[model samples]
Target: MSSVLYQSVVKNYGALNVLRSLDLAVPDHMFLALLGPSGCGKTTALRILAGLDMPSAGKLFIGERDVTRLQPRDRDIAMVFQSYALYPQMTVGENIGYPLWIRGMPDAERRAKIDEVAAVLEIGHLLDRRPRQLSGGQRQRVALARAIVRDPAAFLMDEPLSNLDARLRLTMRGEIKRLCQRLGATTLYVTHDQVEALTMADFVAVMHGGELQQMAPPADIYDRPANRFVATFVGNPPMNILPVTLAEQGIAIGGTPVAIPAARLAACRAAQVVEIGLRPEDMSVSVPGAPNALPGEIYVVEPMGNETLVNVRLGGGNVSVRAGRDFRGAVGANIAVTFDVSNACFFNSAGLTAVHRVNSDGE
Candidate 1:
């Protein structure tokens, strides 16, 4: 396995900018997920790395080799496309061995490698079946097997599980994670799904508007987002941003004083914070007269299987709170929600994170 690097990469289409000054590095054997919404240039970045597309500017490297201008066949990388592009006329064994065949490996050796990879992916029994005869999940396994059979320097996967049903996606997620880990492959996986990115990758590089937002371990990305965009984009229901004012006591949310740690308050004051972010899981429903609570009316209540999500309309904006599954509340009902101010995030006028609380125990 080898490391992958993109230095000052840029992609442009006429007047439109698809990627801007992107500098990313995936260390040897690390799984890095390029995560963003549609048209965020994630796939474009992947294609550039795969040699299927060239960057408008900057350098691309696989290990120490410059591969920016190399042909796709010369990149020493295997790609698992979203479509699982298997030939319908070929059997699974043939599909998996195609890369080896093109490379002029002996037929017996190619077949042996195909069988070994097929067994690894639990698709050994289906090697004789054609693509049309296999299930979607099976076809996906074949795609993965083909990628694995090459033993390439790195792997590039473009939303390889997007076409699978929910259960199949879940199953494939685990399978892919384990497979990559077991192989110790340097992988760059592109997907718009936050769940897949967070669960499968060692590091996640978030992109927005053709620029890199933040790249970090999943836990750090979720708990200590670098800016308001990242704080709002990563979570399940997303973080809630509410206008706030510096109060004499500490900070004010909707005219109600909220107490925060002295250091955090001082940091907010230093940065001239304008807004506060609260994760749904960090806030809770409370009595109307609860101290340090923002009074609001319940706007909606959604009962998720394991927890209830309550959206409350505060004076400044609506904020969702994750509550106990059995908790019940009616829309328009008077309510107050409270959160640990230390756990909240403060953002400056420029939408950059001003202050974020870290656990005293050094998590």
Candidate 2:
């Protein structure tokens, strides 16, 4: 296994800059996901690393070797595409063994390697079938087997689960995570799915507008986003953002004073905080006129089985609150929402995180 590095990598197409001096590092045997929406340069970065596309400037490295100008074949990396790029006419065994065969491995050894990889992916029984004969999951397994048979320095996966059905996607997510762990391989995965990035990767690099937004572990990415873009992008319901005015006591959201810790308040004051962010799970339905509560009307209620998502229309904005499954409230009903000020995130006028609440108890 080998580490991967991108040193000030930039990709420009005419007047459009695709990647803006991106610098990233994937530690040896680490699984890093390049996560972003469409047109966010994630796929471009992966392609540049795989030698399928060249960067306009800067260097790329696999381990200690600079592979900036190397051909794809010489880069010593295996890619699993989103489409499961398997040979239509060739049997599963032939597809998996193709890499070894091209490298001049003996027929017997190539067959053995194919069998070994196929068994590991649990597709050994389908080796004789062509691509059209197998189900989507089985075909994906075959593609994985083909990549694994090469035993390259790093594995590059580009949305390998996007084509599968929802249930199959869930199963394959676990399978891919387990497979990577077992091999202890260096992996760089590119995807737009936040769930996939958060669940499978050791580190997630969130990108937007051809620039790196944040790179952190899953929990940190969700709990302590770097800026407004990251804070609003990574969450499911997304964090609730409200405009706030600085006050002598603390801050005021929609003209309602909210108490905050002295130190945190000072930091926010120093940074000239203009907004506060609270996650859906951080706020709860509270009694009307309660301390540190914002009076609002119920905008909507969604029964999510395990929990009810309540959207309340406050003076500042609509905020989603995670309530108990048994929560029952009428639309337009008067209500109050309260949250821990210590758990709030303060943002500056420039949209950067001014101060973030650290989960000290590790909740």
**TM-score to true structure, per model:** 0.98, 0.98
For all candidates, the clash counts are 0, 0
Candidates' C-alpha lDDT: 0.92, 0.94
Q: What are the runs in model 1 whose C-alpha is more than 4 Å off?
A: 360-363
Q: What tens-digit string does per-residue lDDT give for candidate 2 at 51-156?
A: 9999999999999999999999999999999999998989999999988998999999999999889989999899999999999999899989999898899999
Note the residue pairs that clash in candidate 1: none
lDDT of 1 by residue, 9-49 (tens): 99999989999989998899999999999999999999999
Candidate 2 residue pairs in backbone clash: none
Best by lDDT: 2
TM-score of candidate 2 to 2 decimals: 0.98
Q: What would the C-alpha RMSD of candidate 2 be, to one decimal place?
A: 1.2
